[model samples]
Target chain A: MSESNEEKKDEIQLIFGDKRLDGRRFDELRNIKIEAGILKRADGSCYLEMGKNIVVAAVYGPREVHPRHLQNPSKAVIRYRYNMAPFSVEERKRPGPDRRSVEISKVSREALEAVIMKELFPRSGIDIFVEVLQADAGSRTACLNAASVALVDAGVPMKGMITSVAVAKADGVMVLDPMKEEDNYGEADIPFAFLIRGGKIESIALLQMDGRVTKDELREAFKLAKKGAMEIYKLQKEAIMKKYISESVENG
Target chain B: MRPIVLPGDLVATNPKVAGFGTYVENGKVYSKILGLLDKTETSVRIIPLKGRYIPSVGDVVIGIVREVSANGWNVDIYSPYQAFLPLSENPEFKPNKKPNEVLSIGDAIIAKVLNIDPKMKVTLTMKDKVCRSIRFGRIVFINPARVPRVIGKKGSMVKLLKSELGIQIIVGQNGLIWISGDRKKVSIGEEAIYVIEEEAHTDGLTDRITEFIKRRKSDVGIE
Candidate 1:
């Protein structure tokens, strides 16, 4: 028997049988690649790719804070700018800091500030620039990941690294790392950034959500996101360490 | 070789005092930077592999005079903080002489960090015997964190380079190495310093540097 017209019309098959539209399981994440110390001019730099999202982060300072007035007597201020290239999206995004970019920049700065030992460099500033050359669904999370790696690569003191990922509900099914199309049509999207210490989540640096999910569904999504973050954290470490390891080999 | 550690890695447990580049938390010591874990008898520290120079009292740094004010000179030590060389602290200060006469803009001086206030104002002085102005030399820059390795154990690596290349080198705490000698030897010295900076973490660096100098001399058909 065929389903009713109303039910058939409302149902979108984001999940085909057991696999998602991209032939991935609900718990699968997009392929991620991270590299550190790519920019010689920057104090530290990282280049990362998550699915179709490409992010590059450059860190400068614990240096003097300019404009004089921005100097904080008790701690260094983090100046973060999140920018998307004009050609990043399907339609050319306008250049400069749009409302969404400014908000993301602020939140990402605050997220990194939680782990950074800013008090060590009082009256100074740390400038972090995350540029998205390609944008997909979870560009914000990807930016945070790259920024943290760059900060560490710069040898900035921090209590821990920040790992970020998103979990979404597509077609009534919870999925990890929603792709672009799924994010556009997803029922709920929740992104999280965690500071892990001693193999445990020491704190949640960022938490944001769009759309709706049940209380139980939110908890499940957080667990799923944490798993994805842990995996990404390992990659971040590998990327940072690879710089030194390769140098040793090549020079030897 | 010591194990490489990242930020948040547990470096030591209780009873081991946390030293530089590390912090103590809940009776355990953890690294606060990306570096190599250094464990001593009574303390655990992390030697950072790369970073900007942080000024402290007693560090001899190579600073370029950026501005010459009436009372003092503003020096750029390549650190985040702006360093000042007061006229009185410059050993050559005379009541009748102006600060610019003693050290004008663009002069490079080897000075000691006299003091660093809580606000990060670095005060430098040319009062020490080793402090002087650079008249002629080439400065090679490296990561400040690798300064200790270039210095080696009690000046052994420096001695090797000096004796082998027949060049004069002054390793700055701020990572600006000054090399002065025959033009060819000076350039070779600069390259050797970079090799040391690049492979700072590895062992037997002294031997490798000696071999490198030999190879370079032969390649250039110099002694």
Candidate 2:
């Protein structure tokens, strides 16, 4: 029996007896902490930590646009940049916007643009910067989470709030909030962002997939990711309220 | 009063009208910003907690002259849009005279927002009795959203500050407050204004500020 157990330990064993390598259920998410309005100079800002990933986002504008020609005549334009710190990863990553970051920045900006009331600030621009201070996995989703909170903190009017999460498949089982190791060895990764209103998801603002999965597997992953996102949405709301509520309580 | 509301929170059901900081969707009024909820008999409004100043007609603002154009002066009102103070709106305007002679760059003036067109072009005028250029005074900056609180209900808070401190105060809608008095008195007034800005959301703010100012005056031997 001991010999059989030793043989079962494969080269990369990500699960054991219905539990992921980290002893989390397939549907369970990693620990998350979010704080809003952390930066003073930025119009709005947020600091977020999900699992081992740490991200900070800041928002500026609804202010005058530069270059004189980029101003949108009827609505505000969004300028988004997603960056990773040089010391964030194990292998020292180079500074500045790479191709992957550029693509992520474009998609993330579009996702937030769907919910913002851009027409309110015509001939102006709103800039959002997301900086990843640490990288585990699902950093794009983490960046989106921080950006949404920062927008609200800046008091930029919006049609609704947004929440995001990632689904990972390791050892043929879909999981929520995948760690760095799982992402490296996982079979598939799917990240999603949902527009939330009235305590319900109004629609999907973003959806991107990597690697291959069966149709049924994708549907199952969507369900798991939505459930995880709702939990994150509650935390996001709480983080924003905490700032004002604590002050009121101190004085009231 | 209800709890503070975030964007997309349902504020009222079947409201007849939605006021500022709120919007109507599908016959329901929803808050559009993070703010305190306010409901009237017929409509709903959300008082925004923080935001940049958006120019509206009739609002008196304190602006700095950034450029002296041919026909008008470009004024930085500390808003997203730059305002134009035309030479025609100047009470001292003369025919064929350069605009810079009237008000050169770097001069600060108190003007009224005369017009905001469809494209958000803000126009300012200095023809009102209260409008004038500031030569010397201290300008205190605070969040624009808290300006109403600083003025208090029906200008009572401002009245208290003015009488207690014996200072001339001009509260701008754009959050630039002009205070002029003896050096020590102006500093005390600036401190009091910052206190009001910080505690704007609290109850009985007027009484607390009164006590604070009195204490500060005695501590500094203002008599």
TM-score of each: 0.95, 0.95
Evaluated with lDDT, which candidate comes out highest?
A: 2
DockQ of each: 0.56, 0.56
| Residue lDDT tens for model 2, A1-252 | 011222233447777888888999888989999999999999999999999999999999789999779998899999999999999999999999999999999999999999999999889899999999999999999999999999999999998898999998777778888998779877789999999887788899999999888888899999998999999999999999998774444332
Q: Model 2 RMSD to the real structure?
A: 3.1
- Score residue A78 of candidate 2 by CA lDDT: 95
Supply candidate 1's per-residue lDDT for A250: 28
True contacts kept of each: 0.57, 0.49
- Give the lDDT of residue B118 in candidate 1: 90
Q: B186-220 in candidate 1: lDDT tens per residue?
A: 88888888998878877678888999999999998
Q: What CAPRI grade goes to candidate 1?
A: medium
Tell me the tens digit of each residue's lDDT in model 1 across A132-156: 9999999999999999999999999
